[model samples]
Target chain A: MPLSKAQLLAWLGKLDAVYAAKKEYLTDLDAAIGDADHGINMNRGFGKVMEKLPPVADKDIGTILKTVGMTLMSSVGGASGPLYGTFWMKPGMLLGGKEELDAADFARFVEAGVDGILQRGRPERGDKTMYDVWAPVLEVVKARAAAGDDVAAIVDAALPVGEKALADTIPLQARKGRASYLGERSVGHQDPGATSSYYMLETLRDVLHA
Target chain B: MKKLINAVENVVKEQLEGMALAHPELTVAFEPTFIRRADAPVAGKVALISGGGSGHEPMHGGFVGKGMLDGACPGEVFTSPTPDQMYACAKAVDGGAGVLFIVKNYTGDVMNFEAAAELVAADGIKVQNILIDDDVAVKDSLYTAGRRGVGTTVLAEKIVGAAAEAGYDLDACAALCRKVNQYGRSFGVALTSCTVPAAGKPTFDLGEGEVEMGIGIHGEPGTHRMPIGPVDALTAYAAGQIIDDPAYTRTVREWDGSGWAENTLTDAPFAKGDNVIAFVNSMGGTPLSELYAVYRKLDAVCKEKGLTIVRNLIGPYITSLEMQGFSITLLKADDEILKYWDAPVKTPGLVR
Candidate 1:
């Protein structure tokens, strides 16, 4: 089924909830390798974005995504601002002028958004960044959809890949951001950013199934 | 962890509000996170603008009055301000004499500030930049980014800001900033890690009797970890890395991206000067007494080297929000730079 406007908003709302739920755990992970505020920062920023969503609720898909991008950029701190901000903004640009998006268009927009994020942050696959989870999920979603999978199935298929990627972060030495400063100390900790990305994508899956 | 902030996420915005309300003399545009001198468009003075993340308070913002920055931009904690905000600030602070931007040598800060300078230049606002990479922590390292910018930022802003306030043209102000940066070297040590308010915990763990050396102002991990020892020894460890070596001066001159700009000034004396400015800065959690203690040790070091310490400024000028640590910065100065260091300045955090 195509993603209706209500479904899109609902997905964002669920992502916000998932983020709030895992906020402390995320902070715990950050405490080990980074300044340790990724979870709370994302929750607070996404919460603010949700509050400002009502006025723009009736806008097109492009408008909604762009609004999320700008809101996150202003409200989120650290690398998350530019990373997730680019995530939503690029997809928004790809979906420009479209009032609604079908499954294929949604998949294409997601691909474009992920590409933009890669360009902006320059994070590689195993650098223990959010890209670790995001990259796999992007591939899963793209492949599943290409095989004529339903949107909900594609979402479900991608969710586990993201979770697995998040778990895989624990053994990897960080090669990016503040965690990189820790050198060997960065091992044995899941990247807070990657964990949060899993929650984001998982929430996206749940909302589509709902 | 014992900071007075209500919430970690609210710290930056709340501090900005407090700054604006506390200092009515400063023309503050809270929109883009910039603080300009209330008497901003002061006829012929070149505008001096500098900024980084919010935790390093007072370095850029507090110095935005008389002898320092004409405008300051504050980013979120540990994050560089966006280029759009910087371009807007440069435009707002321009006095028709162009602007000099003092940027720390961090990848994000450098890239964003450079973008802002280009954006401002497209509007015909002449802008030059001086990158500060004075912390002698990591040099040509693969594991870490590079040497961080620490306490020297405070001294550079003051001397260059004074030069601008003294009616030096854009080239002269830029030259003055470059000279200060070239002659400056800084090193820091942290006793306890600072907690980012939002995280509600320490950024790093220093065991009860341990200290991290060569730390930066933004709570970044440093080069070495040693058990916490006497204040004097810690001071020596930090100061030894920053001062009393000709090789240190050579490194400073070579690393400065803008050092060559000062070649036009016939009075550029850092390559052959005796006067120096010593600034010891707290890393948020430390007190004034501790800062003074570090300052005294730094002074002794300069004395031992037979180098004249002509000026001294010490305190919590820049901080990282209750991180129990301090950094020592030394800027080899000249007669002209010394005059500007004594100029009157009034702002919320620094009033003298």
Candidate 2:
């Protein structure tokens, strides 16, 4: 089945709640190596996205996603702002005027969004950034779609790969963002950006399954 | 955190409100949160706009006035301001001459300001963005996001603002600003960690007798921690870091009209016989008297190194929100830079 605009909205709503509930957890992770505001930034960004959703509720998925991206870009005042803002905005630009996305279309959307993240952050794999999680997850998404899996199955198959990638980030020394300032000390701490990306994927899975 | 703030969310807004009430010559906008001089966009003068996280007071905002910045954008505490704020402030402050964005080298600040520059350029307004990265503590630009922009930012704003006031065009103003960044170096030490109001706890913990050396403005851990000692020893250590720092090269992104371009820049080491502007800055909570003590040793150190101090500024000009520490900045000034440094500036945070 194709993923409807309603499912996309539900995924964003679930993300808002997930970030709100995990704000302190993410902040604590960031406190270990970063400036300790990831939770506050993500929660605040999603809150702004929620406010912008009602206005674009009846619009195409591209418009709704673009609104979320713009709101986050303007509201979240951190590196994540532009990083994640482009993540959604690029996909929105590619998916312009689309109201529903099938498994192949959704896989392409994820691929394009991850490309945006790469272009904006210039983060390589093993850099202990959100790209670590996204890179592996994107691979799984592309493979599952090529295998004729449904949208729900694609997301389900990608979540465990993402979770493992997030865990693998704990041993890698950061080479980008504020965490890179820690050098060797950045090891042994799970990357806050990867963890947040995992939560986002997990939220999508729940929305798809429901 | 035991702060004077009424709520975590309203901290930046409330403080900006109080600043607006105090400085009538400046105008504060809340919707996008930017501060500008009351009489901005002076006919043919180039507009200077700067911004960063809000906790470092008397910086971008407090320096907005005649002979200084035309506009300032304040982000959340230690967080960069959004691009929309920069675009709006640039539009509001740009005179016929164009706008120059003085951005620090933090990842967020650099990206946001870059985005804003693109927006402004697309609108057909002439724009240029210059980056300041003077902190000497961070060694490699290959791994981390270069050196954090520190005390030199204040000095750059004053010097570049004066140049703009003296009829420097967009390219000239940007070139001079870049010169200031290359000519300056800074190093900081923290006595204690600070609490971000939202986090409600200290960003890091330091033992009673330990100090974080090579610290940045943010409360993150520094290069290393050492046993706390007398004032003179710490002052010499910071001064030594700046004086002894080797030449550094990094690739910086510049807005080239239509898109971004990588520009490689180098910061040369300070040498003997170089005339310098010695700045002793408090990290918010340090008393002025303690800073004087720091300066007392800094002066002797500069003399010992054969560097001449033509001008000196001592106080909490660029701070870290009561973090109980201080940083030392040494700018090797040339004739032109010295002339602009001596120019008149009137703002809430600085007056000359």
Best by TM-score: 2
Question: Each prediction's DockQ?
Answer: 0.18, 0.75
* Angstrom error at residue A90, model 2: 1.1
Off by over 4 Å in 2: none
For A102-168, candidate 2 gives per-residue lDDT tens digits of 9988998899889988877888998999999999999999999999999999999999999999999
Native interface contact recovery, all models: 0.11, 0.66
True contacts kept of 2: 0.66
Candidate 2 structure quality by residue, lDDT tens digits, B1-352:
7789998889999999999999999999987989999998788999999999989998989999999999999999999999999999999999989999999888889888987897899999999999999999999999888899999999999999999999999999999999999999999999998888877888788999999999888787789999999999999999999999999999998887778888999888999999999999998999999999999999999999999999999999888887999999999999999999999999999999
Instruction: Assess every candidate by TM-score.
Output: 0.80, 0.97
Considering the two chains of model 1, state its CAPRI-style docking category. incorrect
Each candidate: how many clashes?
3, 0
Lowest-sum lDDT 10-residue window in model 1 chain B: B259-268
CA-lDDT, candidates in order: 0.76, 0.92
